[model samples]
Target: MVTSARPQFTAFIGQQLLASGPLAEVAIAVMNASRNPAAPPIIMFADASGQPIDLDLRGTERDVVARLPQPAPDREAATEEASTEPRGRGRPKLGVVAREVTLLPRHWEWLGSQPGGASVALRKLVEEARRANGDADRARAARDAAYRFMSVMAGNLAGFEEASRALFADDRRRFVSLIAGWPDDIRDHVVKLAFSDRAEP
Candidate 1:
């Protein structure tokens, strides 16, 4: 569900942040760091999901960039193409899917009485539900993303388990306190991922 027109990445060498930017930049940075025998292993993470990304850093910068995964088809471009095409449809292509819905007789009667009938009423209800749960949904997603990152990067760190529990419990103070002794970069990234749903103190 994490979609971004321009995806970003963060790279770290051990506990030190190497680079944070687009894939091309991070790939080049990783390539450069790999040359140094003293540098620790480098890891690149997707900023959106806090999941590690493996890049083929086997060639020159241009070659590496060329081998990067192609971006998904832009929704805007698809919409423009659809707009230009001749329309001979009953309803504009809203990408609506028809599905069976079972409801009580009273519910059906209420839906049927709405301004745009059952479909519109159902869509409105669904939208309202989504809006109502938006904050909780975002918080859940942030917790999951933070957990994924921590499981890989901080699993062996002190208080990691307690920090994870506090993360899911939405105890910002306790979570921060638990991770206070972690390396600066790792701790900051964890905080960024865990509290991404709202501004961090």
Candidate 2:
């Protein structure tokens, strides 16, 4: 628990009829009077109507205590939970390494549009995206890796399917990359189709 004596900021509504002076000046004066030397520094602002506000600064002992957020018992627990929460994991896990990445608005929106849903496991989503948008090299490698994928990780196929679906749903990069990597055999099949249509004519 962080138990540091510090000043805080706060505000109060002022009644216009009692307006004996400038509201901003009154707020600053109150804050100055309320601030504790031993506590942290605090800056307060006026309400929309411009009135005197009260803020509580912590730890310093003084005749006038600012109305700062008081130290509560559960505060420690809440802070612990917040500090330990993983960045993008959506929740905390014991042994997992959590990493942070910034996504554009469209990426988030697309993720939200996936079928099995957004709350779906991110690992699956990421792998799916990797697979769906996999390059021709990846496709060839994946085809080559098919034996391994089947042999070593067939048990995880269901997970692969779901993630692949999400990734493919909106991936243009992988879409272009993987198609560009089509194997010779698949490329030949397309050539064969064109020749067959001409031959039929």
Candidate 3:
């Protein structure tokens, strides 16, 4: 879903923006449109700076263009430069295909040495790796979100601890009065963790 959000404009700089001065105008455009990775690669490359600066994109355009996807590599371009180049091939994503690969005797021996694993078809390995990588990325995002919540709540621990203690008090009415309005996220976690604490006689 996220990848689908891309930019369509690639080659053209609008007349007004071109007139306004090169890097100064386009840089703003790129910052505004970063979320849309599919946008024309040229526009994105030109405005990478959050704010615009005065420069002729024409004079500097060669450097800017190098950063963008090219229709084809020039023969004079170094191989390393070619490898780093973007193909500007449009948003059509070609998936990595899985196929059998011949393994050297040492490599085969290495595969056998792995614990909790055996030689799997290369297709399975590729698919599983993609799935695992996706999951790790999602997990990292969730961890960051949870940590933000934890940071806010960590500042209010004394209040939560007091409310939690109130819930364990002998006087039911007093306990109810004490924790009547705790933050829902905190209350939910506290209640679950303490649910077993009430089981004993």
Using TM-score as the measure, the top candidate is 1
- Stretches of candidate 2 off by over 4 Å are 1-94, 115-121, 129-201
lDDT of each: 0.83, 0.37, 0.38
TM-scores of all predicted structures: 0.73, 0.17, 0.22
How do the residues 112-201 of candidate 3 rate in per-residue lDDT, one tens digit apiece? 667533333443465578667765554344333323322333335435455434444433355345445655444333233333223422
Q: Compared with the true structure, what per-residue lDDT tens digits does model 1 show for residues 42-156?
A: 8999977889999888878898999999755655454455557665443335454576999999999999999868876897798699778878777787788889988989999
TM-score for candidate 2, residues paired by index: 0.17
Question: Model 2, range 1-201, lDDT digits (tens) per residue?
Answer: 544223222322221111123333444445554454554333233212112244443344352244333432453354466557655553443234456757898877877787645544465676588657655434333233222222222224333443333233534344333333334332222222212222221
Ranked candidates, highest TM-score first: 1, 3, 2
Which numbered prediction scores highest in lDDT against the true structure? 1
Give the TM-score comparing model 1 with the true structure, all chains together: 0.73
Report the candidate with higher TM-score, 1 versus 2. Answer: 1
Which stretches of model 1 miss by more than 4 angstroms? 1-5, 73-129, 199-201
Superposed Cα deviation of residue 35, candidate 1 (Å): 2.1
